[model samples]
Target chain A: MLEAPAVAALTILILALFVGVEVISKVPPLLHTPLMSGSNAISGITVVGAILAAGSEHDAVAQWLGFAAVVFATVNVVGGFLVTNRMLAMFKKNPKSDA
Target chain B: MSSTDLIQFSYLVAAVLFILGLRNLSSPKTAALGNQMAAVGMLIAIVATLMVQGVVDYTLIVAGIVVGGLIGGVTALRIKMTDMPQMVALLNGFGGAASVLVAGAEVSSRITAGDVPTGIIPGAIVASVLIGGVTLTGSLIAFAKLQELMRGAPIQYPAQQYINALLALGTVAACFFLGMAPLDPQLFGLLVGLALLLGILLVIPIGGADMPVVIALLNSYSGLAACATGFVLDNSALVISGSLVGASGLILTKIMCDAMNRSLANVLFGAFGAVDASAAAGGEGVDQGTATAYTPIDAAVIFSNARSVIVVPGYGMAVAQAQHAVRELTDTLADNGIEVNFAIHPVAGRMPGHMNVLLAEADVPYERLVEMDEINPQFPETDVALVLGANDVVNPAAREDESSPIYGMPVLEVDRAQHVFVIKRSMNPGFAGIQNPLFFKDNTMMIFGDAKKVVIELNDAVKNY
Candidate 1:
């Protein structure tokens, strides 16, 4: 049987999936790369789990695994955000559109 | 409020910011701010995570962050925009690998504490490890293919499907055993190895042309892997954000497949390119007739007399590094009272929206970049269509030749334009190995040269005119 917390987590995940669909449904073709890379940065949420695993007093092997995870997750977050920002910075408005 | 309560609130705030950030990212103007908002959300979450009750090793945590941050940040800053697909694939792999390691550490700690993982923990471990392993290796293969480190076409062997099916079954079997005996490290290792192998097998059969779908699908897997890690750790922030990323990647995958007029199953298993084999059969012998070659002066003459032009760019633009030259041409034509708009196909270049990003990098205004649907109607009324290093997307055969491999896939209808000038390095067919009849058509003129060089000459000619 699923515990109360597990049940709640599942509900949140299902709800979030639909919300994700609804929120990003209208992104134009021009922004697909940024939308992809931006949402990709968000998936680096694994860093939260990685930090917990790394900082806790686990066995040596477990500690090493968590340490590696921290490094990898941080890369995903930092790289993803910077690249998305870099791409977005290049998009200037069309001067003619002002008229 | 207590520290645990504060941490939960921070996670809630992070999730809300992520949602708002993605919502604002659809438009070009607010996209930079949206990215910054998400970055801030990550900072808040990481800070709150550091302050949790049992989290004590500040030294190890800080060291890991520093090392990872340096590598990731430097690569992000220095890598060219043209190599973006490879960079995205590599970073996505890191996320998946982190989830796998986190899951491994969780199970190892449980075993080290002398208790077997039972109930939902075992299943969560299975899901996280399996998906994460697949994403890690799969993305590396995508990186290799895109960077030209490996063969870009689908690498197929005899009985490839049969062997892959067997490998999939073996992975499932290993997963089932690991689930049953959660404390068994040997079984876990076997599962991990099998997953890595399965990832390679899955990606190798896919061709270079279908990379958008491959990258999108792998992006989705990394998110699901993170969601599974959330279940292993009983964390909600990971669950919600993971699901959102999963959904976004899936939607992009669907859109890409639709653009190619192929199903998701087909993209995954169709072994689309097989270009070498098809090319060997008829690649060199297709007598589509002699294409009329022209110079930039002639092109400039046609363009000066014309009123409007549309640019169709493909992978060649990225290869030639010609986005800036194309922008110069756009400016040259605009000064001559000629309207120029870029028609972007969804599956153009290595990724979705890739052409727009390339053009935007050249400081071309976002308004001049038009979607395939919006610009298709205007092509019939336009004067000249200058195609640069693009092939399959503009091939008239996609609409006319039922026997063509790329038939029925939606292509930019540039043939309908009054005059078309195509710049290509050679007469070789496109990535799909399909000969394009558009080049030999009556209204078309082929300019043989590098895309960047040719565009510069066209700009010079237009200036002299």
Candidate 2:
């Protein structure tokens, strides 16, 4: 069983998650597109978690799970970056027009 | 490196990266960098997880990596700009599905082990099963709607809301029962199925106009599922990241709803903006009057003689990539001593700020872009309002009739202008899937062609004038 401090820490973390979600929910539409693209970056944290899990010493099953997590995380990271690039590319000023 | 310490450190780093990435996502210029930073964080977490677990079989891992990479790369390279929204929807659905799968797998593994704590196991199983099921079904429906495979409007029946309410109640009762016996895989699966059905039923009635909001809401649902799974697995990083996504997604959804001046209930159940038979029939009392459609020269003549011109751009302009041409025309008109400006409706394109981004790309000065409120009063004084690739935003019916789906929604009031030159592909209505009555109005002249081509033609016409 986890100690009181560990439980408290977990509780605090969970509460923080709720708070973060609330903050995001209140943002206006004008900010949503940018916010989504921005949040895509934040979603990258899963990659970090996956990487750390993979790198740590673990049993075979744990190792395989960690590896799978890494693979998924990488896909998310790369795919998100590519999409964001494409989206931003739309904003590139047409070179032909000077005015 | 102890497993517990390694996991804690990995989660800490992941949390920090998530926080930073979210902060960076707040602005456009730094959004990409924020994404990169988060990716790096995710990479770190994955590596740490692997290290802690100590897996020797690289074959399966490598194969999975190769296949996933190929698919993702090809998708990125092949998809067109127009299909970006659909692609986003698909990706979001996949994320939701993944979380659900993960939760399901975890629950199954726990149950098979037969060593799970009776009290905690049931809650974990129920949370994972229910959340995952809802996320999967909801996201798939959202994807189908966005892809246009399913009708984009609310498919309504009498007492539909009441039926949905009953389904919700039933789902809740089923979830409670499943929680009482989490080790029963059959019951867990049943609960999941029910939740999935509920999600589909919830989203099916929403109209296409509210798709952005629905997509955002589904995204939130997916995040919540992931967060719930995190609780089941006791993963701090997952909880933090999932909650962040869920929260941000909900916020975006709300913003989209507000932009459309809709409520969450209306978006889910109100059948808002559904184009029924009445909407398709066009205006009832107003007699359809035929007007002499003006040519570029005829419109240019009016504009040349006029004191002010306001340009209203919509999704058509973005589709045509006519912003540059439009910009040139505006500049040419300004040079001719004609005061030119732009009128931008809040929901003018596929996504928020779409018109602004497109116009800005053409190097249109920020000052020239006018919001609907600021420019509506000026429309009466304005000699001409050139509507490019826009139909619904400038529709007078939005304000004229109470029965209309879009009625009471603020419009450009372009009909009030002395002359309205509308450049469009055809007489088709907008994404709202309704016919625009403004096309048949007396003051409006349809310049039928590609918006980009028409704008260039207008530029030439104005220059000659």
Candidate 3:
């Protein structure tokens, strides 16, 4: 089912996969949880696809499904970012009261 | 360039920002900026997708954003640092469920229009539905376990492995059939049901302690499902970001396994939740029947006079919500001219990064919180190891007792310290359900009480000096 353009896309996918591993390799174990949460938040980019699916002209069943998808994906994206920020905020170099 | 060309360019830019965001997030210095970068990338992606031609139904989209944004914002603000893991699990599950719904909707709509996905479209649809279903249910079970709504121990029965294998195979077969017959909603629905069940079965047998790895793996699964959704929709941004998440999550999962000194196969198939018979039996310290106890004053005196102290925290600390009190103890010790550091095991809390987040929430300095490898050597020269509700991570059995199930797992070596003070409710074995010889060591003294109260007492006692 993949055409020539898809072959190019697959190549990009393979390369991106390696880049992902390389970037995460240096993360200190201290930040492993935040990294997981942060990366998990990034995966919320699916909100884009959710929007497209929801906006498309389709049957009622499909429309409702699309609407639900939009809601779920948005929550992932928004919640993920805000939560990651909150965690990282606590990781300041010095305790606020101590300094 | 035309408007369409401009929209595609924005997507390309968003993808690049995401990569940059991930890169920046690897270290502590730039993590916050990294998160913002990713968020901005997401915002751009959303706007660019909205700008696509033939888009409509602004009312439904607006309502979704408002409601979802409200839910996400409110929950993120209200959730305590201790509950972060479950929150992440729920969000990951939401991402998975969205992919399933979107793909299902798209397929059903195509069928309604008398159109069938030929070639790779059908395959992508099948992949999305199958993986998304698994992630959705699997994450929910993880959340339930972390939230203490259900037993955190692994749940298994006879022929469990066989049942899971059969379910996996059946789910795959259903996916293949759906791929071949995209017009058949019944086949598609059957595949979804099987995949969801497979997810529940897959996660139910994992012990609570191993949740970080499970959560990471499921995060990757969600990413793969999103990638499949990207393929179904022919969206480049989705494909790129999805593959990025899938690869990164897999690597993090491997790291979690290494930290615990166990293989992924062992975590999944080892039935770690089942209490070990041998661990339950009597041994050198186990035969003693009870650990030696000490008063809060003695612990305070020992900590105050110590040249260096290392606080090793575990799941019990989180359960007792003692991080704030522990921080107070650290402060009292520091005011007395003693150096203090926190040693965190990789799998220390119910979830990954649990201890660190808790400590950070308590305003613990980032520099003072040390990793296992970095702090192991320090234990020998240390004067006191203040163990707050931590167990198996400090157990000598992981290193000294080869017959032990946790043998060969890297531990915090707190036993090497001149004196050890353990603050626990009782002589209960740790999450692995194993007796720790460290609790019965000659120099080790157990303080019987809740971690929060004991730490507070220790802090007050130190103040008296």
Candidate 4:
């Protein structure tokens, strides 16, 4: 039931994923912490995609699934920011405290 | 906008946000704001997708939002800083699990409808299932070790590496079979199991010293799995974002490997830190005599007499919550016009940036912190190097002897300082289970006590002096 365009799109996506892997393999380790915290933000795209796919349909199941993806993605996005904030806070030298 | 155009635009926006986030993260000052920008961009993208799709039944979505938000907010507020690494591991695992579930559901739905296409879905399913399984199990083990619920040492057995290799091979075979016949639920389950086992085996033989690298590598796997899931769903935004994460994580992992002088193959198969008895044998440094006596000096003598002071912090500084105390001591010295600098080696503590985080928390000025290369030359000129619970990073054997387990590994040259004052509870070896020769050196003095207490005492001594 699949068409050529759909197949081609999927192939391109797969190739992109492979390329991404290759790119990651090349980055240095000193940047791992910052990279992870940054990439976490990018992963939020899943939430958006899930919402679109699920919301476009009229079915209850699709709506609920999309809702779940949104929730998960939101948690990931928000938690990432919170943790990053806390981490950055640690670096903010308290000026008043001597000990 | 047309539906396709809207989706394409969203992808572009998400990609731009990712690039900006990465750029912002390059420096400590902008990292937090960068995270915020990325988060807001993600929110915008998510809302846009939902609006464009126009779904009914926002009730469940609202409920999910409430529940997820509550959990996330509470966990963020409650989790201690010391447990940050474990928290990261758990989060990474969750991401992997979500991708696996998404891929599994898609594959099952396709199979049940009698769609056994030999191309995209099958490949995506295999990739997602495999990578997810590995990431989930590996991350759990890492979390356990970081939490101290499991041993940090590599759990080894006879032919452990071979068994791990076999598991990897089995996983590949399962992936191939799944690709050939996508409808086989049994093969899918087997593949997942094999991948899970491979993940465990992969982590089991990796010692604690290499955990930061392992965690980074596992994170990359999780990102790749998510990207594969995006393909299965045909979501362009997911594909773009997931690919960015996957690429960045892998690069970071490779960098960490290079810092340790390790190859990816060695990291994956060499069973690093699972040394044999011969490898663990005490080097010539350990044969040195242990002294039980030292004349305790007053604080005034330490500050007034010393021309220059170096501060060495370790994992204990992170544990005892003594970074603030250490910072205070530095400030007190700076008040006396005594020069002070912090020495950070490449692998100073549990993770790469452990001390950096600790000191930064204490509000230690960035300019005062020095890297190993910059600080090594100043050690001889340093009148005193105050080691605050550091062990392995200051060990001189890493540079002097070829037979040492950590040979060729760069370490902070604190021992080269004119006077070394080590504040520790006892003469215990570090996580590497190797005694430090610097502890017993003629010029070295061990001040036995809790790090936090000792630092505070040192502060008091400097103040009274």
Which CAPRI category fits model 2? acceptable
lDDT of 4: 0.69
Pick the winner on TM-score between candidates 2 and 4.
4
**Interface RMSD values for all candidates:** 1.6, 4.9, 1.7, 4.3
Task: Give per-residue CA lDDT, model 1, range B316-407, as digits (tens).
Answer: 99989999999988987887788888899999999888898899898888888888888999999999999999898998888888877778
User: Mind giving the per-residue lDDT tens digits that candidate 3 earns over B289-387?
Assistant: 457899999887777678899999998898889999988889888888899999988888876678988988888888888988889999999999989
The TM-score of candidate 1 is: 0.97
Per-residue error for B461 in candidate 3, Å, reads 1.1
Flag the better candidate by DockQ, 2 or 4: 4
**In model 2, where do residues sit more than 4 Å from their true spots?**
A1-31, A37-75, A89-99, B1-3, B54-58, B117-125, B156-170, B278-282, B287-292, B302-311, B317-344, B353-384, B412-419, B428-443, B449-453, B456-465
TM-score of each predicted structure versus truth: 0.97, 0.81, 0.96, 0.87
- Pick by DockQ: which candidate is best? 1
What C-alpha lDDT, on a 0 to 100 scale, does residue B403 get in candidate 4?
67
Model 3 lDDT on a 0 to 1 scale: 0.85
lDDT of 4 by residue, A1-99 (tens): 466745666665566556556544443333344456446646645555455534444444445555665566556566666766777655444433533
Model 1: which docking level applies? medium
Instruction: Residues B227-252, candidate 2: write the lDDT tens digits.
Output: 66566666677777778877777767
Provide per-model DockQ scores: 0.74, 0.30, 0.69, 0.34
